[model samples]
Target: MLTTSTRLKLQNICSRLAQGEFVSLQERVYLQKFAERDRSVSTWVSRAQRFQREGTQQGLDGLMADLDLGRRNPDDPEHPEDDLGDWFSNASPWLRRD
Candidate 1:
C-alpha cells in the first residue's frame, strides 16, 4: 500500500502532469511507483493523453469540462440566488439547534 504522503506526492504530480506542466525525473519515477499501487493515477495520465490529442485545455479545467462540471460559478444564473456560502455561514432548518 502507498503511504498517504506518497499518494499526495503523486496527486500533485498527476495534476501538473495533466496540465502539461514540467515535472522532474524523480517525480516521474515517484508517479510510476504510485501508478503501480493505484489504478486511478494511470487513468489520469492516459486522460491527459486525450487532452493532448484533442488540443484541448489539457488541465484541471479541461478535465472538469470533460466531466461536464465546467460551470463552477455559484453566481451563475442557472443556480438559485440564495448565495449561501456554506452550511455554517447561516442556519437552515437542518441546522436548527432547537
Candidate 2:
C-alpha cells in the first residue's frame, strides 16, 4: 500500500512514463506494482474514458492505434487475441513506456 502522497506521485510518474518521458529510480520502485495487479473491465473502461478525454480528436481509432503502438514491439510477450480486452485485462496501461 502507498500513502496518498505516494499514490499521487506514482500516478504522475506513470503519466510521464506513458508519454515516453523520463522517470527516476524512485518512481520505478513505486510503479512496479502496476505490473502485479489484475486488469479488470473497469480498468479498461477507465483508460478508455481517459483516452476519450485526452485524445478525442483521434477518437476510438486513435485509441486502437495507441494500443497497437503499445504492443508493436515484436519482443512484447502478450498480444491481443479478439479485441484488446485480453491485453487490457492482463496488463496495466501505466506500465507502458511507449
Candidate 3:
C-alpha cells in the first residue's frame, strides 16, 4: 500500500500530466519508483503518456476521472514481475543498441 504522502505526490504529478504540462525527468523517476510497487500507477502513467502523445485533451480528462475514481485498466498486470522487461526498457530509453 502507498503511503499517504506518496499517493498525494503521485496524484499531483498525474494531474499535471493530465493538463499536458511538462513533467521533469526527476519527477518521472520518482513516479517510476512508486510504479515498481503498484501496477495501477504504471498503467495510469502509460495511459497519460499515450494521451499526451496523441494530443487528446478528452482522453486526458477521462484518465483523470478514472484516477479520481480509483479505477484501473483491466489489462494491467496484476503482478509487477509480469512486466519487468517492459518496465526496464521504458525506464532506460537513453540506452542505445549500438
Per-residue alpha-carbon lDDT of model 2 for 1-98, expressed as tens digits? 55678556656665665554677887565466553562432243334434534544377767665564343333445744356655566777795435
Which scores higher on TM-score, 2 or 3?
3
Which predicted model would earn the best TM-score? Answer: 3
* TM of each candidate vs. truth: 0.46, 0.41, 0.51
Candidates sorted by lDDT, best first: 3, 1, 2
- Predicted structure 2: lDDT: 0.53
Candidate 1 global TM-score: 0.46
lDDT of candidate 1 over 31-67, digit per residue (tens): 7876776777766555654454454766897777577
True lDDT of residue 23, candidate 2 = 78
Regions more than 4 Å wrong, model 3: 55-98
Considering every candidate listed, which one attains the maximal lDDT? Answer: 3
In model 1, residue pairs whose N, Cα or C atoms come closer than 3 Å (at least 3 residues apart or on different chains), thus clashing, are none
- Give a tens-digit lDDT track for model 3, residues 1-98: 88899888887888688679989999989998888879878776766655555444457666765454333343456633345566566675576232
Candidates ranked by TM-score = 3, 1, 2
